[model samples]
Target: MLGICVCLFAVFTHVLSQEAEEPVFYTCTEGYEYDRVREQCRDIDECALLDDACKGGMQCINHFGGYLCLPKSAVIYISKEGEQVPLPAVPAVPVVPAVPAVPPSQPQVPRSSGNQGVSLSSRTIRCAPGYTADEQNLCRDIDECATGRHTCGPEQTCYNTRGSYTCQCPPGYQKNGDHCVDRDECALTHYCMHRCVNTQGSYYCECNAGHKLASNNHSCVDVNECDVENPCQHHCYNLIGSFLCQCEQGYELAQDTVSCQDIDECSFSSYMCQYQCINSPGSYACECPEGYQLQGNRVCQDINECETGTHNCQDDEMCWNYYGGFRCYPRNPCEAPYAKTSENRCICRSQAECQGLPPSIVYKYMSIQADRTVPADIFQIQATNMYANTHNTFRIKAGNEAGEFFLRRSSNVSAMLVLTKPLSGPREYVIDLEMVTHHLTMNYRSSSLLRLTIIVGPYAF
Candidate 1:
């Protein structure tokens, strides 16, 4: 088996050598003669086909056209003295020192200042993963941006990194695909006092008329017009965005909101006064006339000048008050021709003849109130002229047709006059009382007369 294997290897080696020496062309179309596969036209790999394609001391290397045979070593072998004949000498090649190799983990710069004896032809260097070697034998970062290799848009900015790059937009802009667009902040929200003005990278606020911007710069506040000036004649009231006028106490606001006018209370028919109504600035006053005073604020009452001692009546006359006026009434009545005495009493000269003719009665006037219905003591007379002892004899008569007054004698022999009923109606009556003495010495009777007046109502005074 070993001999057969050896024989097969020798045949394969011979075949590869013959194939290498003579040119072989695969059968294919003329334009596409060479193909990568062996089934078509292609270059023959002699080393692959036969492991020992080259002879001793020769190296086999395949090429596009054919194969190459190179000498593996060219050194001469000198035999020791007395050993044997020395081998043939090959051509000499100059020796050069090897340069230090830079590790693949780091990059290295070329050593330009070494000894002249040192050679750089055999130097080996490598760059780090993120760096590339330049012609100067130095590592440098790649600039993708300068080389037009960045993917940033026209409006974007490109930044070069170590072996990489970056793309971005400006501060107030947003990245939208290839564009660096301005952000519309105003469109996103209302950020102004009254109106929003959007600008490049900024925004502002504005206020309308009669308004002012607030501290926040995004809202508006009403401007108070009344605070700057007094617009009302009396008082000024401030409202939102406007002003109003108001009047003090008794006044009113005019049609114009800025003016105030006085109100005439007297002009209204509801003004209530007893007798006189007086108007003032914005109000009215109620007053009484000469002889009248206000009972309530709205009613009038007659003032009694006589009772208040405010009258001008004489000593012999009486003062009387009516609704709005006063009058003076005489106290007593007598015949006009009869002269009044010094005491203001009435006397007649015919009294002397009546005294001489019979026992005449002299009538004296008396005034009485109708409220005195119970028997009231009228007079106590002690006779002095003719019948001193006939005090018990008396006669009484009332001139009243209604018979309201009569006279009676008491236990002490005194005369009294009484009314039968309390006088209530508007009427006046008279009473006559006559007294006579039963014992007459000169054959003449003594007589006396009394007159009484029953008065009711105001005239009773």
Candidate 2:
């Protein structure tokens, strides 16, 4: 009996083993499922097999007939630690390789790919780091000129080199030289003056020392000194490179250059006038004194004023003016009463008392001061204008023998006079001078020298 029960248990165990190896499927409304792999039953996520597997955002499900497939939205995920966890973001669906259209009999789906082909798992593009199609396309080189990818500034030129281009100045420019070197105008001696200013490679023209350049041309001109402050003492004229100074007339240059002096015309005869001319710095003149008219001989002479009527005498008198002297006449109407008829006194009947008179009783005494000097041609006046009386009958006594004599005279007017003749023999002198009326007289003697009175009278003072 114990052997029979053991044999039945072996058969049951064999049947269960066969069920775990081969699982059975049911229709839409199926029976309860069996799973013998772990000797326990498990539920299925059946929404994956539903007709409309999910809503737009969730999958729909149907469970075995009474076990309906439900949407995944109704379920919540749980962590291994038993805490509720938020649902993770849905992963983007992987794009599969596009298949070409096949005929009706051909297999619609592809077989599993072999490992020999390139796999997405090994490529960075498949690892979620995606690539752009433009980058993958064939890359063209960056043309500097075409794309305007140049570093050169305006007015500069650019040249292309491999991988990069270089900046450059235009023609006639050098690397070390001024990139835009101006042409060196001063290098050639064409328009330069004393010096040249080099700017870059070019220069401007200028004048040299003591010279000025003309606006029209490159020629240099000499500075004109005469036009300015006048370097010359006189007229100034400009020359090519210099000027000339000339001393003007009426002046002479001194040792020092600055000043001019008036030349003494009198010192030299060149510009002197006639008649003892005198010269001034710029002119000349003549000089003459009084009492002397300019004569033909150019000298002063004692005037014979009496003959010339120059003496101030009475018009009624016949004046016999002489050289250096004069004589006067009252028109002698009567002869000398004392004169003898025949070497003897005339005894006229009515004039008996006047007869026998000694011939012309003479005045006795005379004295004078006579030392004198006179001026000449170039000298002053008043020294040469005078006269001496010679015709008067004033007698001198031989007995007196006077060493001195005096002179006096009277006419229509009185006079005061200075002597011109030099005194010689006379030293002691005395004189009595008087006239009864218009006939004035002077009496003098050798003893009267101590009181020789030169009496003055009325005249043109």
**Top model number, lDDT:** 1
In candidate 1, what are the lDDT values of residues 31-150, reduced to their tens digit? 112232222333445456445454323566543334555444433333445354333332222111222233322223333444222123533224444345576544455787888888
Poorest 10 consecutive residues by lDDT, candidate 1 = 6-15
Q: Per-residue lDDT of 42-111 in model 2, one digit per residue for the tens?
A: 2333343233333222333333222232234355343435455543333222122222322222312224
Model 1: residues with Cα > 4 Å off, grouped in runs: 1-188, 197-204, 208-211, 222-246, 336-461
Off by over 4 Å in 2: 1-190, 193-211, 222-234, 245-248, 253-261, 267-281, 291-461
Question: What do the candidate models score in CA lDDT, each in turn?
Answer: 0.51, 0.35
Instruction: Quote the RMSD, in angstroms, for model 2.
Output: 38.1
Model 2 lDDT at residue 148:
77
